[model samples]
Target: VLDRQGLDAFMRQIRSKFESSLIQDEKNERFPGYARRRWGGALKTLLAAIDKV
Candidate 1:
């Protein structure tokens, strides 16, 4: 778990579109295939920053 590979695996283990659209896109602009760049990047960056902290 010291490297990014472990983190990626962790994400894959828990990630799920079925979790909820609100979680998948916090801003609630889209869901599933409708999600766009800003929403996708926002979620990724949020997770990355949290992992760093």
Candidate 2:
């Protein structure tokens, strides 16, 4: 099992990866804003659950 510090680091890594992908998608101009909204909400929910741990 991961300690608190490890969990925090993992969360930061996950967040960084998510943000980078979102930025890349914006640069590619492939997905629409509505799609991004859906994805962002999903990520937020996932992160919230992680925080509970």
Candidate 3:
């Protein structure tokens, strides 16, 4: 039993957090010798590409 306003607010909050994290992660990705193992060097992909130097 959720109200319309309450549901909208909840969704907005979730979106805000998700967008913020995505932005930060992208920023971190644009660097030399950036090592990303688990989550992949960059997102929006099917598999992760490991960087080995």
Candidate 4:
């Protein structure tokens, strides 16, 4: 039980870090624009599929 609790805590920390990175990325205008320009079609297709659901 202790091991499981420790693992859960570790996973939560990792998830928090990942969320922070995503927030940082969203705040970055240049990175987002570049990504959109590079993968505009794919992104749009993905968004459409998501919307359908």
Highest lDDT: which candidate? 2
| Candidate 1 clash pair list | none
* Model 4: CA > 4 A from native: 26-53
The digit string of per-residue lDDT tens for model 1 on 1-53 reads 34677656555543443244446566665454355454455557647855894
lDDT of 1: 0.53
Per-residue accuracy of model 3 over 1-53 as CA lDDT, tens digit each: 34556555655654555456655667686662333332332332222111110
Model 4 lDDT at residue 34: 45
TM-scores across all candidates?
0.33, 0.48, 0.40, 0.41
lDDT for model 2, please.
0.66
Each model's lDDT comes to: 0.53, 0.66, 0.44, 0.52
Cα shift from native, residue 1, model 3 (Å) = 3.6
Better of 1 and 2 by TM-score: 2
Judge candidate 3 at residue 35 and give its lDDT.
Answer: 32
Clashes of each: 0, 0, 0, 0
Clashing pairs in 2: none
User: What TM-score should be assigned to candidate 3?
Assistant: 0.40
Candidate 3, position 49, lDDT = 18
RMSD of each: 7.6, 3.6, 12.9, 10.9
lDDT (C-alpha) at residue 21 in model 2: 67
Error of 3 at 28 (Å): 7.6
